[model samples]
Target: MPILRRFQSRVKFFKASEYMQPKAEVQNLKHMRTSHLVEPNLVGKHTLHACKRLVERILTHKEEKAYKVGIVGTGGVGKTTLAQKIYNAENLKGAFSNQAWICVSRDYSDITLLKELLRNFGVHHEQGETLGELSSKLAAVVWGKSFFRVLDDVWEPEVWTNVLRTPLHAAAAGVILVTTRHDAVAHATGVEDPHQVDSMSAEVGWELLWKSMNISDERDVEDLRNIGLDIIRKCGGLPLAIKVTARVLATKDKTDNAWRKFINRSAWSVGNLPTELRGALYLSYDDLPHHLKQCFLYCALYPEDSTMSRDDLVMLWVAEGFIEEQHGQLLEETAEEYYYELIHRNLLQPDGIYFDHMRCKMHDLLRQLACYLSREEASQIILEN
Candidate 1:
């Protein structure tokens, strides 16, 4: 079998319950009931707009042998979002003959990363090929072509220094964009001045909160505006916090009492180190229904920035007995409902670039929180190892 087919086979095997008897068959899930591609309402995203213009200028006007740029920020500060916007810009279409977006998360081996890059660039290689063989194949593919590539969530520098540098050395005109949390990684990728993404301002946070609430009435907006601003200040103007906080508030009755109750919650005033923004995330996690909690936490088992297939996740949930039974519904169907609920609550975001609603990725902060909450289980696994 070919490499891709074998990979699919392994995934199928992994999704099956190894020690349990066969269970009732559940029909494969169809289309997603709701879209999770909701664009955040960043009020006057001046920095983002300016960054796009800069990317265009570098890629279109620069005459370097191989142009590179980096976008660096703390997790949840919208580095990936900015890169996505630049990747899909309309004005830049047809500017390069080849383009690809590769998510290089914290856990990536050199060979696997190289293979993924080849796959995205429409190159094929045998399954057991050695590193040198793959490298030469990649070199041949980009030998004389103008290509644009986005490497998202880079953690280390070896991806370029060890694997990509030699292969891409001969490209006619290559433009590479990298998004990372570490300035070291950005600099190692040869970017002297990586664009830094900052948290939103107080004003922008309010816009995000109000937009997320989907509130319509001006009177209600005015009435809650003072309390809303006060509560948003606790979020520290982080977009992720404001958005998750809005989801929490949206569940309550739209009244001063409800908003006040949320503002007085303990999560809003806890930590100042690592991330003050995590308070909002904890609130969102706390708000999950019992069954959905298991499903949401289970997602943290995936590597950082990795996308999980909705189908495989639901099946695993069923196998783990996480999905509670509902009247007149199959377990898979019920599990699918849980999956969509997490997405609706913004605990899971649709992978907008690579896959549609069929796959989802959890924000790194949210994943960290999940792992923290499940530290006992993690500890047990560590001891066993």
Candidate 2:
């Protein structure tokens, strides 16, 4: 009797264990479905020396419970690429318990941004929910965990207040990284100094150009190398410009004459740029203040790779009536502010060849953009040659 009762008890225990197995499986599935860790592929030899150090601090620094890092640069200056590299670094892989990247462009909607972010977290939403409700829920769920969030292409400061400022900030281990082209936006969103990404150097630009053409750098064909170096210089050390111009040149004759013709041709005659590069360059131009728009386009008057002094450029603007005399400010002073703003925004390069900050040069592709937009969009006045 005792043996039979013991066997019956064992049978009941086995039945209960079987019943819990499906529940355990369901719980495991639920846990597995919510993972949002992302490791992006790092491309190019960006060698972002400054950016890497900032990223390292983000990964290892435990001094702060939470913080925000700002990456500010002009479009196509490789901000996105640098951010991707930071996101995928070995030090960052296990640094955060959860990770998400979201694009918060100028057109981003508050509700949509929250919903997308939640979706990245593998959280589903009903159609009629309000932003407040979503934010509360997100904050609740993300409260105790370490969260690494990347907000790419942020345009307005309101994006932070509405979307991530409360929830992510409340998390004890949250680190929010934001990318913006505007210094104002960067300063508003960050608690620390924002890293300003600079244009690639001439050597880096040449490497990128050659890499785009699938050519080896080891073989130094002198004539072709000279023209290629000249082309790189004309590209103004902007990677996208070098890439677009190189891709265009790749389809032409392999000889130096073909490249020389491309270099010699007026930017206005180069026809359309690669739409990707054109659109990226145009956004920076489009964002300029109306009063400064013509001031910037005036840069196209100079030849590609030509350097002009700031004083000369400002004087020209004043002569052209682009600069209006403001109350208590010299026309040249106001115009110099415009020049510095352009340089600050990466629209113009300081003349490194002359090693003079007083001098500036327009990138050829940007010159192409300026000339094209001035003609097509504004019907800008053209002085006779």
Candidate 3:
């Protein structure tokens, strides 16, 4: 029943497996309008277009046939971004009678997802309904209607085959767009030709770095070009890594000495990241001001893909004494400033679905790093349900 389970030993913790899924009470959510899924200003425009082409080729469905397509990539490689672009494409307007965007976290609950799907279809299920009842309600809603669904951040194929596929297939015609970190998940979910999102090239990576920092001066470009490329190389062409590193650079003085000092930071050389995303993630955490570090790491306690409201985070930080008292500021105000700072540093991402400053989410990889660091700091920080 724990969202995150721990081994009997005090030090080791693991997320709840899909089978022993956590229970989530369904809220009566308003229909998810495509207008609400605001697309972030993305880098690598060419990749977006290419991904769109792939989706179109597979899902165009001139005869209203059902299609299952996937956009697969490593964490932070922009799979979600591509899916958003496709979801908002002008040409695809009016092609489906209804659409829904669901964020399927690592430990998804079948009943919760079924309820969410019905919510997106503008249907409300009665309390105490069985899985059979929820499925029937979902099937009724999609029956003979054209549907489009975006299942974002899916972890396992069973979430599709065992939970969603049956009811959704009742549509007159439908297209299921799945975004995942594993190609196996895509294929298992019926995405026969999942599109693999490649890492950014050196040129695009530098362009993204410069754009993120608003660095356009010809002399500045020349000054930082070599060091910037080296930084990008360490990033391994991951957009998330490049952007996080850019935030760290943006806060430093734009001088060769200052830039060199940053590039030579010791964290870059060592630290275990999922793969090539090594130092950039650690550097982002390391560069955080001491006060913000605790606040940022505390976020790792939440489940992956979890959204936290700004007020709630600020209050939590205040309760835990993570916020320093400013001479003329309320603790809440200081805590709020910390929240915005994390967002500025790209340590926290704005929850796109809500489209407001009130809520934000931590990237999964960042959360993992935070959890790892938290465990290292206080061996007694035991995770339980």
Candidate 4:
């Protein structure tokens, strides 16, 4: 009886331990799911192909230097879209045991940024550490592991040299991919000839438009088709512009008059449309708030892609009679407010924001959009030109 009682107690103890084990395991899984996670989505075929080739090169050559792949193009040209696709590809998931995607916006703080990167690597450090110490912690975490790090929408080389590259270099076989709108940025990063992505083909553009419009058959309306082609041409092969216009057209019933109206409205701007990129950027410009509209249009006074000094731009704004002075606010301060507003809207890219922060010039597409709006708003000025 005593032996039997002991046996029964042992069985009860084992049963309790088994029941609690699953609960603890489930809680651990939930914790893991909530922490240091990345979710990826499909981009398109062309982008996926490019990504696969890059991953293969990285995996095949352990001794070879890590490749720095860059995607460069005008804004809204789908650089990020393509980069995301490559990052999320299922086949390439095993290439790197540890990967992180960091979006370096204009407002990235160095220490905070390092913490985010380390968190992805499953390294936890106390919050109030110095930038140097945080970088050291990050370096230690990535030391042995092969890392795939993507710095998306990089606007400055200083950020790369000072903050990201130092620690990232410690990781063996680490691949860094950058996406940007500027050629000089790629050059500054020492990438051997960044890949410049051009606008989609007209056929692809049309297909994208159809997808956006949710239209199945182009054959039902021949006249509409002709007008649509003309509109697509006006867009300058920009996917964004094509899709926006298609959405606009799609909402209206299929009719020759409706198609003609769109064509005619877009027709008068003929040669004014930017030649470098089809006018997909125009829609974004047209949607700007009034204050930003004035600020962007004011950029036309400067040369194309010419970097402009922040103080000089403000002084110019004061001299050109655009900004009105208010009590307790200098004209320079008012001008800066507008500059930041434009930057926030993705209308302006920061040149450098140090002791003497100087902002460079706008992209050709943005300049063109500004010019288009300026002409449309002040037709008399355009007519004189």
The clash numbers for all candidates, in the given order, read 0, 0, 0, 5
Top candidate (TM-score): 3
Tens-digit per-residue lDDT, 1-385, candidate 3: 1111221221232134321235554232212232344435477867767756965763566236458888899988888778877777776777788776888868677888898888788888788799888988888888889877888888999998998878877878888888899999999888887888988888788888988888879899888888788778888888989889889999899887888898888988765554544688988998887888888877776666666779878976786777888998999999999999999888998765664578887888899888777665544444321
Against the reference, the lDDT scores of all candidates come to 0.72, 0.63, 0.76, 0.61
lDDT of 1 by residue, 228-268 (tens): 88777877767777778888889888888888888888765
lDDT of 1 at 262: 87
| Candidate 3 CA-lDDT value | 0.76
CA lDDT, candidate 1, residue 340: 79
| Ranked candidates (lDDT, high to low) | 3, 1, 2, 4
348-375 per-residue lDDT for model 2 (tens digits)? 7665334446876565557777766655
Worst 10 residues of 4 by lDDT: 28-37
**Model 1 lDDT, residue 197, Cα:** 86
Error of 3 at 246 (Å): 0.9
Tell me how far the alpha carbon of residue 184 in candidate 2 is from the true structure, in angstroms, after superposition. Answer: 1.4
lDDT score of residue 323 within candidate 2: 76
lDDT of 4 by residue, 1-385 (tens): 2222222333355356432243212221111111121212222456556667765654665333345777799776767656666676676677787876776644345765677788788888774688899888888887877877777777887667888778877777777778888989877876666777677766566666656566667574444566666666767766556654664566466877776765665433545565543344564455455545666777654544445667866875665556767799988888888877665444565544234335544644577666665545555444556
Please give the RMSD to the true structure for each candidate, in Å. 7.7, 25.0, 5.1, 21.3
Backbone clash tally (model 1): 0
lDDT of candidate 1 at residue 267, scale 0 to 100: 64
Better by TM-score, candidate 2 or 1: 1
Give the Å shift of residue 160 in candidate 3. 1.3
The positional error of residue 181 in candidate 3, measured at the CA in angstroms, is: 1.1
Instruction: Give me the displacement of residue 161 in model 4, in angstroms.
Output: 1.9
